[model samples]
Target chain A: MIVYLLCLLLFCVGLYCILRKRNIIKIIVGVIIAEYAVNLLFILVAYRRGGRAPLHSPDAVIENMVDALPQALVLTSIVISLASTALLIAIAMRIYQKYRTFDITKIRELRG
Target chain B: MNYFAGMIPFFVVLALGGAFLVSLAGRRLKIFPDIAGLLTTFSLLLLSVLAVIAVSGGGLLVYSIGAWRPPVGINFVLDGLAAFMLVTVNLIAFLVSLYAVNYMERYTDKWKFYTLFLLMLGGMNGVIITGDMFNLFVYLEIASIASYALVAFGTEKHELEAAFKYAVMSTVGSLFILMGIVFLYSYTSTLNMAHMALVLAQRGTSNILLMVSILFIMGFGLKAALVPFHAWLPDAHPSAPAPISAMLSGVLIKSLGVYALCRVFYNVIGINPALSSVFLVLGTLSMLIGVFLAIGQWDLKRLLAYHSISQIGYVILGLGLGTPLGIVGGLFHLFNHSVFKSLLFLNSGSVEYATGTRDLNKMGGLIKKMPVTGRTNLVASMSIAGIPPFNGFWSKLIIIIAAVQAQEFFYAFWAVLASILTLASFMKVTKYCYFGRLKEKLKGVKEVPVCMKVSMSLLAIICILGGLLILPRGESLFLGKAGYSLLKGTSYGNEVFEEVNK
Candidate 1:
C-alpha cells in the first residue's frame, strides 16, 4: 500500500514538472520522470516479496519468482519511451534553433 | 471468405513494408514514393473492403500472433466494429495518398512524407485490429509519434512549436493510458481484452475500477480532443502538409482516440449509467464549445480543425445515448464525418496548393477559376452543416431522433441549436472563401492537378451518396452490425470466447 502511494506521488511529481515548468528541456525531463514512474508501477504490480529472477533450472521450484511478463512489457515500453524522448530532444534542438531560447513562453508563434 | 479473414495481418505488413520500401527506393527515383504510396494505400483500401465483406454476417475473425490462442498471446480481431472502422480509415487513407501525389510535390523530401504517412496508417490499422490492451498502447504511440513528426515535417518555427506541444501532451496522455492498463492488468490478472472483460464481470465494480475508468477517459478524451483536452488539435492539424491535414483531422482522432475510447469503456470496462452520462456531458460540451470557438476563426484550416471537434461531439453524443438507434447513428456519423471531413481538408489543401494561402479573406470567387475544388468544397460544407440529401443530415437526424426517444429533450435542443450554428459558420466559409467576388490578385489561380481533382471529386460524390447507407437494406450490411456488437455490451466477452472456441 505504501509503495503504491509512493509510486503515484512520484508520478504526480513528474506531472507537476511537465505542467509547471517553463523550460523545454525541463518539461522533457518531466515527461521522462512521469514515464519512468508509470513503468516502475508496472514492475511493482508484478513484484513478489523476496523474489529472485524467474530463471529456470532442472528440478527447481517456481515459488518466490516475480512475474516476468511485465518485465518484458517494460522493455517494450522503455524502447517506446526512448524513441519519443529522442524525438522530443530533436524537436527541442530545432525549437532552440528557431527561437534561440529554451523557454516555452517565447515559443508562442502558433496560437489561437 | 476465410481467406479474407486471414488477410487481416496482411494490412499491417503491407503498410509497414511499403513505408520502408519507399524510403529505400525513393533515394534514386523521384516518382517512386508516389507510386509506392498509391499502390500500398490502394491495396489497404481493398483489403478493408474485403474485410467488411468477410464480417458482413456479424462474426469475429481472430488472428492470433504466432498461432497462440487468446488470454495468452496478443491477437488481432476483425469484428463488425473493427471492419467498419477499417473501411472508414483505409478509405480516407487511400484518398489522401492520391491527393498527396500532387500536393506533396511542393515539399523537398517526398519519400520521407510517404514513409511517415504509411507508418501512421499501419499504426491506425493495428490500433483498430489489436485485441490486447498493451498492443493498443504500442500502436497508438506509433501512430501518434509518426503524426508528431509529420506535423513538424516542414521544420519551420510554427510547425516545430506545434509539434512540440502536441508531442508533449500526447505522450502524457499515453502515460495515463499506460497507467490505466497497468491497473486493469493488476486487477484482472490478464492483458487480453476478452479475458479481462470476463474477469471484470466476475469481480464487479470497485474503487480501483472507477479509478481506471477515469484514467481511460482522461487519456482517450485527450486523444480525441474533447473540449477541455483539445489544446493541441488546432495547432497540430493545420501545421502539417495539406494531405496530412486531411489524414489527421479525417481519421486519426477517430481511430486512435474515439475508437479506442469506445472499445475500452463499452466493451472491456462494462459501461454503466454514470459513465454514459459522463460521455453525454463531455459530448455536449465539446459540441457547443468547439463550434463557438470555431465561429470566430479566420484561418480556413483552423476553422475546419475546430469543426472536427464539433463533429466528433455529435458522434460521441449519439454513442453516449447507448440505444441501438443511437449506436447506429453514432457509427454512421463516424463514417460520414470521415468522408466529408477528408474531402473538406483536401479541398482546403487544393486551395492552398494553388493560392499558397489558407486565409479565408484572401480567397474569393475561386469557383470561377477552380470549378472542381469550389464545387467540392460546397458539397463538403453542406454535408458538414447537415443540409438535406447529403450524408451529415441523415446521421444528425438519427441522433436527434434517438435523443428525443430517449427522453433527453434538452440535449436534443442543444443538438439542433449546434446544427444551426454549424450551418451559419459554414455559410460564412462559403461566402468568404469561394463566393462574393473574384479577387484582383487571385485571377491567376487554376484547378489542381489530375490526381487531386480526381480524389476530391471522388470524396464529394461519396458525400452526396453517403446518405444512402441509412436505407433499411444497406444498414444491416454496414452500420447495423457495428452497432449491434456494441449493444451486445458485456456479452462481448462470451462472444469473443465463443468465437475462439470454434
Candidate 2:
C-alpha cells in the first residue's frame, strides 16, 4: 500500500516539474520522469509478495508466480518513451538554434 | 467473399510495408516513394470500402493475431465504427498523398516526408483496427510521434516551437492514457477490449473504474483538443505543412481522440447519465469557446484550426446526446467535417504556395489570379459555414434537430449560435481574401500546378456532394452502420465474441 502511494507521489512530482518548469530541457526531463513513474507503477501492479520468477520447471510445482505481462509491456513503454525523448530533444536543440535560448518564455513567435 | 474477413489485417500490413519499402528504396529511386505512397493509400481506401460492405452484411469480424483467441491474445476487430473510421482515414490519406506529390516540391527531401506520412497512416489504421487496450496505446504513440516529427519538418523557428509544444503535451496525454490502461488491466485482469467489457459487465463497477474514466477524459480530451485542453492545436496545425495540416485536422484527432474516447467510454466502460452529462458540458463549452476565439484570427490556417475545435464540439454534442438520431448526426458530421476541413486546408496551402503568405489580411482578389483555388476555397468556406446545399449544412442541421429532439434546448441554441458565428467568420475570410481589390504584391501569382488542382477539385466536389450521403438509402450504407455500432454500446462485446466463435 505504501509502495503504491510512493509511486503516486513520484508521478505528482513529475507532473509538477512539467507544469511549473520554464526551461525547455527541464520540461522534457519532467516528461521523462512522469513516464518512468507510470512505468514503475505498472511494474508494481504486477509484483507479488512472495512470487517466483514466472519460470517453469518440470521438477518444481508452479505456484505464487508474479504477473509477467506488465513487465513485457513496461519494456515496450520504455522504448516508446525513449523515442519520444529523442524527438523532443532534437526539437529542443533546433529551438535553441533558432531562438538562442532554452527558456520557453523567450520563444514566443506563435500566439493568438 | 469469405475471404473478405482476411483483408482486415492488410490495412496495417500494406501501410507499414509501404512505409518501410519507401524509406529503404526511396533514396536510390527518387520516384519510388511517390508511386508507393499513392498505390498503398489507394489500395487501403479500396479495402476500407470493402470493409464497409462486409460489415453491412451484419455481425462483427474478428482477426486474432497469431491465431490467439481473445482474453489471452491480441485480436483485430472490424465492425461498423472501425470500418467507418478506416474509410475516413484512408480516403483523406490518399488525397493528401496526391496533394503532397505536387505541393511537396517546394520542400527538400520529399522521400523523408513520404516515409513519415505513410508511417503515420499505418499508425492511425492500427489504432482504428486493434482490439486490445495496450495495442491501441502503442499505435496511438506511433501516430502521435510521427505527427510530431512531421509538424517540425520545416525545422524553422516557429515549426520547432510548435512541434516541441505539441510533442510535450501529446506525450503527457499518452502517459495519462497509459495510466488509465494500467488501471483497467489491474481491475479486469484482461487486455482484450471485448473480454474486458465482458468482465466489467460481470463484475460490476467500482471507484477504480470511475478514476480510470476521469483519466481517459483528460487524456483523450487533450488529444481531441476539447475546450480546456486545446492549447497546442492552433499552433501545431498551422505550423505543419498544408497537406499534413489536412491529415492532422481531418483524421488524426478523430481517430486518436474522439474515436478512442467513444470506444472506451461507450463500449468498454459503458456510458451512464453522469458520463453523458460530462460529455454534454464539455462539448458545449468547446463549441462556444472555440468559435468565439476563432472569429478574430487573421492567419488563414490558424482561423481554420480554431474552427476545427468548434466543429468537433458539434460532433461531441451530437454523440453525447446518446440517441440514435444524435449518433447518426454526429457520425455524419464527422465525415463531412473531414471533407470540407481538408479542402479548406488544401486551399490555404495553394494560396501560400502562390503568394508565399498565409495572412488573410495580405491576400486580396486572389480569384482574379488563381481561379481554381479561389473557387474551391469559396466552396469549402460555404460548406464549413453551413450554407444550404453544402454537406456541412446538412450535418449541422441534423445535430441541432437531434439536440432539440433530446430536449437539450440550451445546447441546441448554442449550436445555432455557433453556426451563425461560423458563417460570419467565413464571410470575413471570403470578403478579405478573395473578393477584395487585387493586391499589388500578388499580381504576378500563378495558378497552382496540376496535381494540387486535381486534389483540391476532388475534395471540393465531395464537399458539394456530401449532403447526398444522408439521403434515406445512402444513410444505411454509410452513417447508419457507424451510428448503430455506437448505439449498441457494451453489447459490442457480445457481438465480437459471437463473431469470434464463428
Candidate 3:
C-alpha cells in the first residue's frame, strides 16, 4: 500500500513539474519522470508473493520468481519513452534555435 | 481452418517495409518514395475492403500471434467495429498519402514524412486490431510518438512549439493510460480483452473499475481533444502541413481518441450508469465549448481544428445516448465527418499551396482563379454547415432525432443550436474567403496540380453523395454493422471468443 502511495506521489511530482514549469527542458524532464513512474507502477503491479517466473520445466520446480510480463512490457515501454524523449529534445533544440529561449511564455507566435 | 486467421501481422510488416524502403531510397531516388508510398497505401486500401467484406459475412476473426491461443498468447480481434474503423483509417490514409505526393515537394526530406506517416498508420492499425490491453497501450504509444514527430516535421518556430506542447500533453495522457492498464492488469490478472471482460463481468462493477474508467477518460479524452483537455489541438493541427493537418484532424483523433474510448468503455470494461453519465457530461461540455471557441477564430485551419472538437462532441453525445438509433447516428456522423473534414483540410492545403498563406483575411475571390479548389471547398463548407442533401445534415439530423427519441430534449436543443452556430461560422468562411473581391496580390493564382485536384474532387464527390450511405443497401454493409457492434457492447466479447474457438 505504501508503495502504491509512493507511486502516486511520484506521479503527482511529475505532473507538477510538467504543469508548473515554464522551462521547456524541465517539462521534458517532467515527461520522463512521469513515464518512469508509470513504468515502475506497471512492474509493481505484476509483483507477487513468492510467485515463480512464468516458465515450465518437467524436472525442476522454481519458486519466488518475479512476474516477467510487466518486466518485458516495461522494457518495451522504456524504448518508446526514449524515442519520445529524443524527439522532444530535438524539437526543443529547434525551438530554441528559432525563438532563442526555452521559456514557453516567450514562444507565443501562434494564438487563436 | 479458422486458426489461420493470424495474417494480421502482415499489414504491419508491409507498412514497416514501406517505411524502410522509402527512407533508404528517398535521398537518391524521389520516384521510389512516390511509388512505394502510393503502392503501400493502395494495398492497405485493398486490405481494408477485404476486412469489411470479411466482417460483414463472418462474425469476428481472432488472430493469435505465433499460434499461441488466447487467454495466454496475444490476439488480434477483427470484428465489425475493428473492420469499420480500419476502413475509415486506411481510406483516409490512402487519400492523405496521395495528397502528400504533390504537397510535400516544398519540404526537404520527403522520405522522413512518409516514414513517420507509415509508422503512424501501422500504429493505428495495431491499436484497432489488437485484443489485448497492454498491446493496445504499446500501439497507442507507437502511434502517438510517431505523430509527435510528424507534427514537428516542418522544424519551423511554431511547428516545434506545437509539437513540444503536443508531446508533453500526449505523453502525460499516455502515462495515465498506462497507469490505468497497470491497475486493470493487477485487478484482473489477464491481458486478453475478452477474458478481461469476462473477469470484469464476474467481479461486477467496483470502485477500482470506476477509477480505471476515469483514468482512461482523462487519457483518451486528451487524445480526443475533449473540451477541458483541448489546449494542444488548435496549435498542433495547424502546425503540420496541410495534408497532415487533414490526416490529424480527419481521422487520427477519431481513431486514437474517440474510437479507443468507445471500445474500452463499451466492449472491454462494459458500460454502466456512472460511466454513461460521465460520457453525457463530457460530450455535452465538448460540444458547447468547442463551437463557442471556434466561432471567434480567423485562422482557417485553427477554426477547423476547434470544429473538430465540436464535431467529436456530437459523436460522443450520440453514442452516449446508448440507444441503437443513437449509436447508428454516432457511427454515421463519424463516417461523414471523416469525409467532409478531410475534404475541407485538403481544400485548405490547396489554398495554402496557391497563396502561401492559411489566413482567411488574405484570401478573397479565389474561386475565380482556382475553380476546382473553390468548388470543392464550397461543397465541403456546405456539408460541414449541415445544409440539406449533404452528408453532415443527415448525421446531425439523426443525432438530434435520437436525442429527442431518448427524451434527452435539452441535449437535442443544444445540438440544434450548435448546428446553427456551425452554419453561421462557415458562412463567414465562404463570404470572406471565396466570394469577396479579388485581392490585388492574388490576381494570377492558378488551380493546384492535377494530383491535388483529383484527390479533392474525389473527396468532394463523396461529400455530396455521403447521404446515400444511410440508405438501406449501403447501411447494411457499412454503417449498420459498425453500429451493431457498439450496440452489442459486452456481448462483443462472447462473439469474438466464440469465433476464436471455431
Q: State the lDDT at A99 in candidate 1.
A: 88
TM-score of chain A of 2: 0.96
Top lDDT hit: 2
Q: What ranking emerges by TM-score with the best candidate at the front?
A: 2, 1, 3
Per-model DockQ: 0.92, 0.89, 0.83
CAPRI band for model 3 = high
Per-candidate local distance difference test = 0.93, 0.93, 0.88
- Tens-place lDDT per residue, model 1, B1-502, is 2666568898789999999999999979998999999999999999888888898878888888898889999888888999899999999999999988888889899999999999999999999999999999999999999999999999999899999999999999999999999999999989999898999999999999999999999999989999889999999999989888888898999999999999999889887999989998999999999899899999999999999999999999999999999989999999999999899999998999999999999988989999999999999999999999999999999999999999999999999999999999999999998998999999999899999999999999999999999998789998998998788887777877787778
Q: Which ten contiguous residues of candidate 1 chain B have the minimum total lDDT?
A: B1-10
Better of 1 and 2 by lDDT: 2
RMSD of each candidate? 1.0, 0.9, 1.4
Clashing pairs in 1: none
Fnat per candidate: 0.90, 0.78, 0.86
Candidate 2 CAPRI assessment class:
high
lDDT for B8 in candidate 3 is 64
Write candidate 3's Cα lDDT for B57-115 as tens digits.
Answer: 74778888887888899989887778888888888888888888899998988988998
Cα lDDT for residue B387, candidate 3: 95
Order the candidate numbers by lDDT, best to worst: 2, 1, 3
> A-chain TM-score per prediction?
0.93, 0.96, 0.90
